[model samples]
Target: MRRTLLALLLALPLAAQAAAPSALKAEDVPSLLKPPAHGVRVLALWSLDCAYCESNLQALLKLQRAHPREIELIAVATDSVAQQDALAQRLHAAGVDALPARAYAEDTPDRINYLLDPDWGGELPRTLIIRADGKRSGISGQLTPDKLATIAP
Candidate 1:
């Protein structure tokens, strides 16, 4: 029983690591947006402080649920590394903590923002849609249901 208990304790950290969201870097943006063999990649950039981010997240979640297989939603938080715990909590509250996500891991997020999109201006509630063919469309501000439908469709 002691041996079994030790093994379980060793596995606990691994399990927690597997469940935690990953830290995103500026260099990681390209790979994250790479189109899958099938379906479009939807990248949503938000922050817990953004007033409209929750609504945008809800809309994205709805879109994801509608086309579970055809659309892949990835959330990026434009928050500092120090806010990681709170970021995770906010994502949980928004019902997207389970989605593949990342928080800014750099002290200068503008560099990461530029890597994400040269014209983005680091705006909150930004969404990017990458088609299977590699074409990308980006929009800043909360995504409307109509816009979400058009992208997912």
Candidate 2:
């Protein structure tokens, strides 16, 4: 019984980690963009294979730390379902597994990309800043401190 209990304890964390990222669909983008009433939101889109995604995530983490109360940050992974474990590892390494996150559920990513932004062209490391009043702006590529300030400020 003790060994069984120990196994269960060890498995609990794995289960939680496995469940961390929700399956994101095209229909969910609009609601995800809407922050709580009078609250600012930041949405980060990344892919495991993107060269600049890690740095972009670090910038978002810094922004979140600076404005914990004012900004709500969400991360979305555009990787295939087969890369879920790798995606989780990346999120854990970046210390953002605790934040709200979504992973693409479909194999064809263009559908999700179009739902996110028709003009996006499926770029990696896309960052979107939505203000309390529902205004939004986005940039693709690694974010600079100057640009982060504009988003979180």
lDDT by residue (104-130, candidate 1, tens digit) is 888889988888878788878899888
Kindly report which residue stretches of model 1 are placed more than 4 angstroms away from their true locations once superposed.
1-20
CA shift of 133, model 1, Å: 0.8
Worst 10 residues of 2 by lDDT: 32-41
Candidate 1's error at 128, in angstroms?
0.7
Q: Which predicted model would earn the best TM-score?
A: 2
Q: Return the clash pairs for model 2, or none.
A: none
Clashes of each: 0, 0
- Per-prediction TM-score to the true structure, in the order listed: 0.84, 0.85
Alpha-carbon deviation at 132 in model 1, angstroms: 0.5
lDDT values for all models: 0.81, 0.81
Lowest-scoring 10 consecutive residues by lDDT in candidate 1? 12-21
Query: What CA RMSD would you report for each candidate?
Result: 3.5, 2.8
